[model samples]
Target: MNFRNPVRRALVAALGALTVLGASSLHAQEIKERNLRFAFSLAKEHPLGVGAQKFADAVAQKSGGKMKVTLFPNAVLGSDPQNLSAVRGGTLDFTSMATGLVASIDKRFMVFDLPFLFNDAKEAYAIADGPVGKGLLDDLSAHGVIGLGIWDLGFRNMTNSKRPITKAEDLQGLKIRVIASPIFIDLFTTLGANPVPMTFGEVYGALESKAIDGQDNPVAVIESAKFAEVQKYLSLTRHVYTGMPFMMSKKTWDSMSDAERNVIRAAAEEAKQEERKVTAAKEGQSVETLKKSMQVNEVSPAEVARLREKVQPVTDKFSKEVGDATFQQVSAELARLRTASK
Candidate 1:
């Protein structure tokens, strides 16, 4: 009898048993885990919500079922500012928030919202994924939030029911609903429109009740939120570049192990890339979708330039409030990107 055959069989049987035992241990661990909650200010069908879900899925898979993330979309917990406060207070674990809202905490964030700063998604991502973006993220850490990465919110457009905004003059006297951000209010006011600062949740009702004659948002957002049904004109202004910052509570982040932090950070970055792709595709199709039900007008390049000129004063005012050094840095970055693109 060859003893080699029996030895090999015994080794194989022991290995199989170890594998089964390890898997059973993992299963037991998963059953005793707690889920993390992610809050965002968009409907479940919106890009941010979709990205949040993707992040949750990645976290759950990467943690091997030991950690999970649940999404609270459409301001379920509160508005952007409120949710951010909750995250800071450790009442909320995570949130995907617009830079506009974050700017209220640190005015430097307004640099990202500069009008006509980023021409397209690629240019935006280039600056955002580089030094400038990292600096902004680091800035948020001082506010009790750990910024993970930047996600796309698409180019901002103008929508109105009073009249088609083909030229700058058309914006005169129209009450446009804007996010509750001073920068946005100043931008619309400088463009001759009366800006009504309101929460995102109240916009649709405001538009429907004629409390606001118009509002501005990305084409994808306008279509997804069905703003077309409440408004008549869609102006391809592309005035502002919006970005959503992925953030976690500093307390929660500090409590996590280094391995867990690394995993969550990696998942957030992957989700950001996915968000940009989804937003780009949705923006390409949204205009056509809106045209089916509403009067859609693509502002000519010359008109966009004219609009830019009209809002220059707003930028000037914001630069003073946001600090000259930061504004200059952002302007320099935009110029460099444009030159390099050409």
Candidate 2:
């Protein structure tokens, strides 16, 4: 009211400063100190483990050291199914597992487990990062989890103590361990092998005890899990491209503020990219390393085509389960990518 007076001007300036300070205080309050746990079944040196650490570090940095994430590698928490339950129930905050395990919650995810679905990591990445993958992730909200993004696990290959799998017939009568998922069981069964559904944590012991003759996984996984010690053959089957869906408990997500959620989303994305890079870099190296202890061979292109034909019935059955719309959408996307690449 007394703008001409110096005293009044000083009083107005003090009020303005107080308003700004109050706003800053409220902004700071939006991000509270939080500690979270992220568990997986891989060794600490695995790309997923490295990415988890990076995610934790990024969260701490982005939250100005108000947030922290502890990593639980080597399935110390439990198997993938158990961890999935804990995350959904809010007992655990974060976890990442093969999409095949996710198929138990929603069969549409089985699309990723289809044999010979992707020609290479590039094609797989395109689909995983595209609209189709986003839709599948968004659907997870109904299941009490928040899907962050798809992290790469490279391609699945066959390994066994019995013999080198040069052709589809080689898998005949050999007992092989597979993810406890319908698609995997069907895939192996269609290939003439007796597929024994089992959890990843149980595979090594089973192989060592001769409970199962062999198992299949990415070269990175085979090498990291030290399967070379117990298994004799590694076939570069590249049958399925596995993607790890990084997820958080919906209960935990609901408890976070908008600022906190943003931090989580950004950190997850960074970790996803880092994991992919590390996985790609180690894949070739892992294959070379495994050769020293295990007989290694690549399935010929003609034989892979034959193997693909053998599994077509299995694919057709699951495509129905995954729904025509979802299957077609992915097929169209893959077609576009192939055409563009040419």
Task: Give the winner by lDDT.
Answer: 2
Model 1 residue 20 lDDT score: 100
Write model 2 residue lDDT over 94-177, tens digit each, in one string.
999999999889899989888888989988888889998899899998999999999988898988988899999999999999
List clashing residue pairs in candidate 2.
none
Candidate 1 wrongly placed segments (more than 4 Å)? 1-32
TM-score of 1: 0.90
Per-residue accuracy of model 1 over 160-187 as CA lDDT, tens digit each: 8877889989999999998888899889
Model 2 lowest lDDT segment of ten: 24-33
TM per candidate: 0.90, 0.94
lDDT agreement with native, every candidate:
0.85, 0.92
